[model samples]
Target: MNAAPPLTPAQISFFHEEGYLIVPDVFAPADLEPLRQELHREIDRKARALKAEGRLENLHEELDFDRRLAAIYRDSKENGETIMRHLEGLRGGGFHAPEMFDVIASPKLLAKVGSLLGTGEIVASSVYRIRPKLPNIGRGVVPWHQDSGYFSTHCDKQLIITCWAPLVDATVENGCMQILPRTHRGEVAMHHTGGNAGFLVIKDENLPDDPRKAVTAACPRGGVVFMTNRTPHCSTPNYSDHIRWSMDLRYQSAEAPNNVGLWPESLDAAGKADDAFYEKGNVACYPPEADFLVQSRLHPEQVTNYAEYVRRRETYDRTQANFSAFRRWPESVATK
Candidate 1:
C-alpha cells in the first residue's frame, strides 16, 4: 500500500483547533475484511476459553455480543490485570502479529494522524477493543470522558488520538458511538468509576444540549471516525441480534514517554542506563502468583515491532513526497 495523502490545510486546522478530524476513505473497504475475519476468530477463541472456565454457560445462547467486551469479565481484582495483559499482547506487547502493525502503521491512516500532529515520525500505542452487542442486553451508555483520563502522560496538549473503526453497519439502533460536538475544547473533566461494567469510568455529568442532539456516528462498515482523546463520547447498549464489533487505536509521538513496564523483557539487560521507568511502572495489576504464566506468554518481539514500525514510517514519508494520488479502492465495496 502507498503512503496516505497529506491532510488538507483545513483538516489540519480542524484537528488542532477542534481536537478531532474525520477523514473519509482512509483505507479501501477491501482492507477491512481481513481485520473483520481476525476479530471473529479472536472473539470465538475468547468465548471458548470463557466457556471452558465456566465464565459462560454457552457461547451462542448466553454470550451477549452487544455488550462491550472490555466490561464483560468478572468484576474481580484480577479482572483488571486480565484486561491489561490481553491489551499488552494485542497492542505490541504480545505475539508479532502483522495486524498490530497494520492498524498502527497503516500508510493511509498514519498520514492523517501525522497531519494532525504536524510530524511524520508517529508512535502508535493503542488498545484493541471489541463491542459485542448481545441479544436483549442494554447497550450501556458510556459516560463522557477523555481517553487521556486513563493515560499516564502529562503534556499540555492531548497525547492520545482514538481511531474508531467498525466491522458492521453502525446505526443508532445498533448502538453506534456518539459524540458531543465541540466539548473537547473545555477543561478536561475529572473521572470516577462508572456504572457500565467493572472498572469503566466516566465524567460526572451528562452532556448539555440545546439546539443540537448527540451526534451518532452511524456509518457503513469500513468507514472510520477520528476523535480527540478529550472528546466526550459514548455508545448505547446494543440490543441488536447481531454482534457490533469495532477497534480503537492509540498513537503518540515517537519522542513521547510510554508506560510499558508491562513488557519486562523489552528492557535492556545492560546496567539500566536511561531506562528505569519501565520497571517502575510495570507492576502487575493482578495478584503475584497469577502473573507467572501471563508474563511468560508475553513476547519481546512486540516492543521491537513498535520500534520498527516507527522506523519504516520514515521510508513511507519519502514515498509520500513522490506520490500524489490515492490508490484503488479495496474489494469489499463489491459485496456492499
Candidate 2:
C-alpha cells in the first residue's frame, strides 16, 4: 500500500475558497492497470461501437437518470461477445461489478476523498458511469449543467460531493470537463431539461452573458476534479483519435438526506413496512450498493417522519421535468 499523501494546506484553502479543486498525481498512473484493462476492453467493444454507430441509447429508461443518459454495460453481450463478466457481488442492486467496488475502496482513493470531505465513514459507492468518447464523434459534448439540476429538489441542501475519475488519460483534447470556477456560491441555478443527456442547463436568464470567459479545469487521469452538486460544468467532444472513458461518483455523509425512500423493499416484502413508506423515503435511498447510513442530521422527530420528505421529493422531481418552463435548444444542439 502506498503512503497517503498529506492534504496540502494550499489545497485545503483553495477548496474552501473556490468550491472545487483538482488534485493531481493523487493516484499512481500505473496503479490503475487492472481497471484500465477491464475498462478499455468493455468500452472498446460495446461503448466504442455504440459511439461509432452514433447510437446514443439507454435501455433503462424507467430509471430517473436513464432518460437520454447513455451507459455502458460491463457484461452486456448485445454488441457481440464482450470480454468482461459482471461480478456476482453488487452494490445497491445496480449492475456494478465487485471489481468496481475494489477500485472505489482503494486505500489511496478513499483517503483522499475522506480527507477533503471531513468524514471517515463515507459511501462513495452508488453509481458507476462509463461515458464513452469515441474518436471523431460529434456526440461527445455534455452540455453545460449542474448535477442537482436533474435530481430531486426536496432536500434542504445538496449533500453530495462528486468525484470525476477518468480511467484513461483525460485531456482538453478529448473534451474533458470544463468548469465555471467559484460560481457554486449562487443559488442552485434553475434547470429544466436540456436536449442532450437530459442534462441540467441554466436558462439564459439565470446564466451570465459571458460564461465562456470562465476558467476550465482539465487534468490528467488518476487526478480528480471535485465539485459540489451545484457547480456548473460541461465537457466537449472526443475529436481526438483515442477514446475517453471516465466514471462519475457521488460521495455523501451518512447524515445527509438521500433519494432512496424509506427502508428496503426486501424488508417491505417481509411486511416490515407498507407501500406508503416505500413511496416517500425509499426512493431517496441510493441503490443497495451505497450502503447509506440512515442516521440523518435532521431532528430525530423529522427523521422519523421520512414519508413527508419522500412525498415532497417525488412531487418536486416531477415539477422539475415540466418542459414548458425550459428554453429548449434546437434539435441539433440537443443531439450533438
Candidate 3:
C-alpha cells in the first residue's frame, strides 16, 4: 500500500488546539465508487422488500441517487418512516456489509488516522454511523453532543477519534456538520435527549458563550473532517432536495480498554461498578455493536476479516434481545 502523506506540523498543532480538522479529497472517486454502489444496492434491496410487503407503491427507480430515498418517502403516504427504519438498520457500528468493511479498512484512511493517533495499532470502533441525511427528516438532523457523552466513563481518558466523510458534496444547504472550535479542551458538557430525532444534545445553556465561533464544515466528496471524541458538533436539517450521504467512523488506540467484543458493563461517573446498570449479557455502549481491529502493527495477521466482522455482528444481533431496553439517561429526561 502507498504511504499516505503525513499531516504537517501546523495541521497537527491546529487539531490539538482547535479540536477538529478538515482534510480535503482524502479519497479519490474510484476509491469511493465501491461503497457508493453498495449503498445503492442496499437501498434497492430495501425498496424491493418494502414493495413486496405492499408498503411502497413504487420503487422510484427513475430518481437519481441523491433524490431516490427522498422521492420514495415523499410519494409514500406513510411519510417515509418505513424507509427511515430501513436506513436506520444501517447506522451505528453498522459495518457488517463487505463494502463498509472495505471503506473503514482503507489503508490510506487508516494512515491518516494513524498520523493523528501517533500509533499504527488502531482498533476500529464498532460505534461508527452511516448517516443518510434526507431532507426534513427528524432523525437526519443530529443534535449537538459530544461523542464521549454516549460512551462509558471507563474510556474517558482514552483518545478516540471520529472521522466524518461525505460521499457527496456536503454544503450548508445539504446539512453539513457544524462544530464548535476548541470545545474539546473543556469537559464534556451536560446533555439531554431532545430534538426532532430525540437524540442526545447539549443544552443551550451549556453551549459555548460565543455561538458565532461555530463554523460549518462543508467539503466536497471524499473530503474528511476529523474530530476528537469530546468535540461538540451537529448537522442541521437538510434543506436541499437530495439526500446528503455521509459516514462517521471512529478509531481508538488498540491498547485502550473498551467493550468491543465483550458485553457492556455499566460504570458510574467515576468508572466504577454500577449494579443497577449492569446486565448479565448486555452489549456495551450506545447502539452496542461489535468492534474489530482495522490496523495493527503488533499483530497484523490477527486483524479481522470481512467474514469475522459479519460473524461478530450477527452474534451480537442475536444475543442482544433486550438491547432496546438499555438507556443512557433516566426516563424523566425531557426530549422536547
Candidate 4:
C-alpha cells in the first residue's frame, strides 16, 4: 500500500499553536461525489415515504439537493418541524447512512489523519455527524463548545481529532465553522445544554474575554478543517438560500485508551465488566453504538465493511439493554 501523506513541519506547528488546521485540496470532486449521491438517494426515499403518507403533496423533485429538504418542510403541513426530523436518525451521536461508509473509510482521509497522529494504526470514532445546515434555520447555528465536552471524562487525556468537511463551498454566510485560537491549551470550559437544538455550549461567562480572536474557517468543497478535541469551535447561522452540507468525522490513535476501534475488546478496558464503575457515576466512551476499525496496520483485513458496520450497529442496539442517561457533567466539574 502507498504511504499516507505526511504533514509539513509548518502545518504541524500551526495545528499545535492554533488548536486547528485547514488543509485544502486534500480531496477531489470524485472523493465527494459518492457521498453526495448517497445523500440524494436517502432524501429521495424520505420524500416518497412522506408523499405516500399525505404529509407532502409533491416530492419537489425539481429542487436541487440543497433546496429539497427546505422545500419539503415548507410545503408540508409539518411547517413547525425542522428538516433534521426528516433526515436519518443519529447513530452513536451521528448519522450512520451506509452510503457514507466509503467516505468515512477513504484512504485519502486516513492519510491526512495518519500525518497528524504519526501512526498508521488509526481508529474511526463512532461520534461522527452529518450536519445539514438548512437556510434560515436556527438549528444549524451551533454554539461555542469544545468537542471534549460531549465525551466521557475517561478519554480526557487521549487525543481525538475532528475533521469537518463540507461537500459544498463553506462560507461565512452559509454557516462555516469558527474557532478560538489556542483554546485547546486550557481545560474544558463550563458548558450547558442550551443552543438552537439543545446542543452543549460553553456558558457566555466562560467565553474568552477577547472575542476578536475567533477565526472563521471558510473552506471550499473537498477541503477539511481539523481541530483538536479540546478546540473551542462553533458555526454561525445559514443565512443563504441553500443548505450548507457538511460532515464531521473523528479519528484517534489506535493505541489510545478507550479506543472505539477495539469495540468489544475495549469494552472491558472501558469498565463494561465493572458494575461499580457505573454506580460510581462513571460512564463509558460512546456507550450507545459499536465502534469499528477503519485503518489498522496490524489487522488491515479486519477493517469494517458496510455490511459489518450495519451488523455490528444492529447487534449493539439489540443486545445492549440500557444506555447511560447521564450526558452532563456534575456542578463541581462544570463550575471549575
Candidate 5:
C-alpha cells in the first residue's frame, strides 16, 4: 500500500483557525471492513454465549452488524449493555485487537495529525472509544462538551487532538457530529457530569458560543474529523435505520504531559500501585488510561509495538488505580 499523504498548509491552517477539520479519504471504505467484521464477530460470539447460558433468547444472527445489536437491545437492554461493555471495555482498553490498533496507528491518518501538531513525536492515549449508536436509542447521543471537560484542569491549555472516524458514511440523519467552530481558543467551559450515558456535558448557557452557530460535521466512511481538546462538539440522535458506528481516537504531542514510560514498579493484579505511581500519573492530562509513544522520529527505538501497546493498556486497566483528583464540578443536571 502507498503511504498516506500529509495535510496541506491550507488544511493545517483551517484546523487551527476553526478548531476542527473533516478530511475525506483518510482511509478507503474497505480499509475498515476488517474492523467492522471483527466487531460483528465479537457481538455474535457474546450473543451466542448468552443464548447458551439461557440469559438471552434471541441471538439476532440473521441481522448484519448495524441492525443485529439493535435487535438485541430491543429484546433486553441488559443484554445490549453487556455487549457494549465487553466491546468498549470497562474503560476504553477492552477491545485492543490488532484491527482496532491498525486504525489508531494508521500511517495515513498520522501523517495529517503530525502536520497539524507540527511535530514528529506523537503520543497515543488509551481513551480511544468505539461507538455504535443504535437507531433512535439515546445511548450514543452525546451532548455539547469539549473533550477537555473530561481531562484534568491542569491540561486546560494543552493540545490533545481527537480523531473521529465513522465506519459508515456519517450523514446528518445518522447523528453526525456538530462542532462549535472558533470556540476552542478559550478555556474549557463548565461541564456537568451525568450527561447522556455517563458522558460529560456542557450546558447551552455555558457554551462559548451560541449552540445555534454550530456546524454539522457530516463525514463519509474513511474520512476523519479532527478536533482539539477544547473544541465544543456533540452528536445528534440516530434517527436512521442503521447504527452509526464510529471511533474517536485521541493523540497528543510527546511534549505534552503524559504517562508514556511511568509504569508502577509494583502494580499488582489487585490494583495496588505504589503511591509514587499514582502521584506521577495524576500529572497526565487524562490519568486513568495508558499513553504510549506512537511515533518518534528522533527516538525511533522508543516507539511502542503492537504487543507493548496491548501490554500497557491491559496493565493500566487491570490496576484500576485512581490517578488525578480533578476539581469538583456542580452536580445534578435536570433530566426529563
Candidate 6:
C-alpha cells in the first residue's frame, strides 16, 4: 500500500468553505482493486448459492461487477434483494470482509481524514454505507438532506466528517452526489420521513440554500469526497450503463461524544441489550451502530482490529437501541 498523503492547507481551506471537497488522489487506484474484486467474488458466491437453492433463474455470470446485480434484478427482484442484503447497502447490515475492513481502517485513508479533521484521535463511526446505485433505478435516488439529519440533536453541534469514495468513477450520468456548497455552517435542515429508499429528505422550502447552486460531485475510483456532517447533499439516478458503487464512511474527533468501548453485557435476537447500555448508547451520534477508535496516538493499543470490529458490528447489529436524543421527523404528507 502506498503511503497516504496529507491534504494541503489550501485543500483543507476549500473543504471548510465549500462544505465538500473532492480529492481525486487520496489513494492509488490499485488500492481499491482488492475490495472491488472481493465484492465481485462475494456476489458470485451469493448468486451461486441462490441458484443452488432455486431462488434465482440466472447466475448472470457473464456480466461484470457493475452490471451483474442489475441483471439479477432484471430477472428477479427477490434474487437481487437477497444478494444486496448480503452485501448490505444499509448501516449494520452484513458485508463484513477483510477487504472492506481494510478500506475503512486504511492508514492511507486515515492520514487524509486526520488532515481534514485537524486531530489524530479520530473516532470512526459505524455509520458507513456500501452504496450500489444501479442504472436508471429510482430506488437508488437519494433525496436532499444533511448527514446530521440522521443523528442525535446533541451531535449536530459537533464535527463529524463523512468520507465518500466511489469504487468506479462517479459521474453525473452515473448518479454521483450533488452537494449544496457553502451551506453546511448553519442549523441542520428540517428533514421529513418517506423520501425515496426510506431516507430522510429536506423539502425545497426547508433547504439551507437554493438548489440551483448545488455542484455535481464526480470522483474517481481512488478519490474521496469529504463533507461535513451538516453538508446538504443528494444523489441522482444512474443513467449510465453500469453501477455506481461507492462507500460513505464517517469519522469524528475523539473529544466529541461517542459510544466507543461501549458493549452490551448481553444481547439477544429480539434487539435487546443491557438496560444501562441503552442509556449510555444514546450518547453516540447514531445510537444503533457501534463506534470504534480508528486512530489514537494516545493509545495505539486500543485501535480496533478486524476481529474486534466484526464482533462489535455483528453484536450491535442484533441490538436495536431505544433513542430519544434525536428529534424524529414526521412522515411525508406530500402528494407530489
For candidate 3, write residues 1-336 as lDDT tens digits.
657776777888888899899998789978988888877777788789888888887898887778888888778836466655545554333435788889889987898888888889888876776778888776688877888877765555568899999999999999999999987876667777655566777766777545568879998898899999888898898988889999889998777654454533433333333454344332244334567788888998978898877776665544443344333643325442
lDDT of 5 by residue, 99-154 (tens): 98888888888898999889979999658888889999998899998988888888
lDDT of 1 by residue, 1-336 (tens): 654687899877777665566565677778876665565455556656766887654345344433334334433324324433453342223322456456555767777777676665554553435444443444334545566555433432545567877767777777788777676766555555434553234533433332145577776676677787777677776666665666676665544443233232332343121335543443211101001110111342343354454343333223222222211212221110
TM-score of each: 0.64, 0.66, 0.87, 0.86, 0.94, 0.93
Residue ranges of candidate 4 with Cα displaced over 4 Å: 1-4, 77-88, 91-98, 259-284, 317-321, 325-327, 330-336
RMSD of 1: 13.3
lDDT of 1 at 196: 56
lDDT of 6 by residue, 1-336 (tens): 656678889999999999889999887889989999999999999899988888887887899999998999889878877777667635454787999989988988899889888999999996888888888878788999999999988999888999999999999999999999999999998899989878899998899989999999999889999999999999999999999999899999887778776675554554445667666644788867778899999999999998988888886765645433578888896712
Models, CA RMSD each: 13.3, 10.0, 4.8, 4.3, 2.3, 2.5
What candidate 1 gets wrong by more than 4 Å, as runs, is 46-96, 203-213, 259-336
TM-score result, candidate 1: 0.64
Off by over 4 Å in 6: 1-3, 89-93, 266-282, 321-324
Off by over 4 Å in 3: 77-79, 90-95, 260-287, 321-336
lDDT of 5 at 326: 62
lDDT of 4 by residue, 1-336 (tens): 776466788888898888899998778968898788778777777678766777767778898777887787667636314336534336332345666878888888888888888888877776677778888878778888888888766766678899999988999999999898887877777777655576787765787535468899999989999999888898999999998999898888876643243334334533254564455543435656566678888998977788877666655543443644335754322321
Error of 6 at 332 (Å): 0.8
Candidate 2 structure quality by residue, lDDT tens digits, 1-336: 656764677886687577678887767877666766654344344445565676524433342221112223322334311212221112113223434545655667666666666766554434445555554445456776776664445432645677887766788787788877777766667555654544555654565334775556777778877877777777877666566767676776654544333333334333233566545554342322223332233433333223432333233333322212123333234322
When 1 and 3 are scored with lDDT, the better candidate is 3
Better of 5 and 6 by lDDT: 5
Clashing pairs in 5: none
Report the candidate with higher lDDT, 2 versus 4. 4
lDDT of 1 at 314: 31
Q: State the number of backbone clashes in model 2.
A: 19
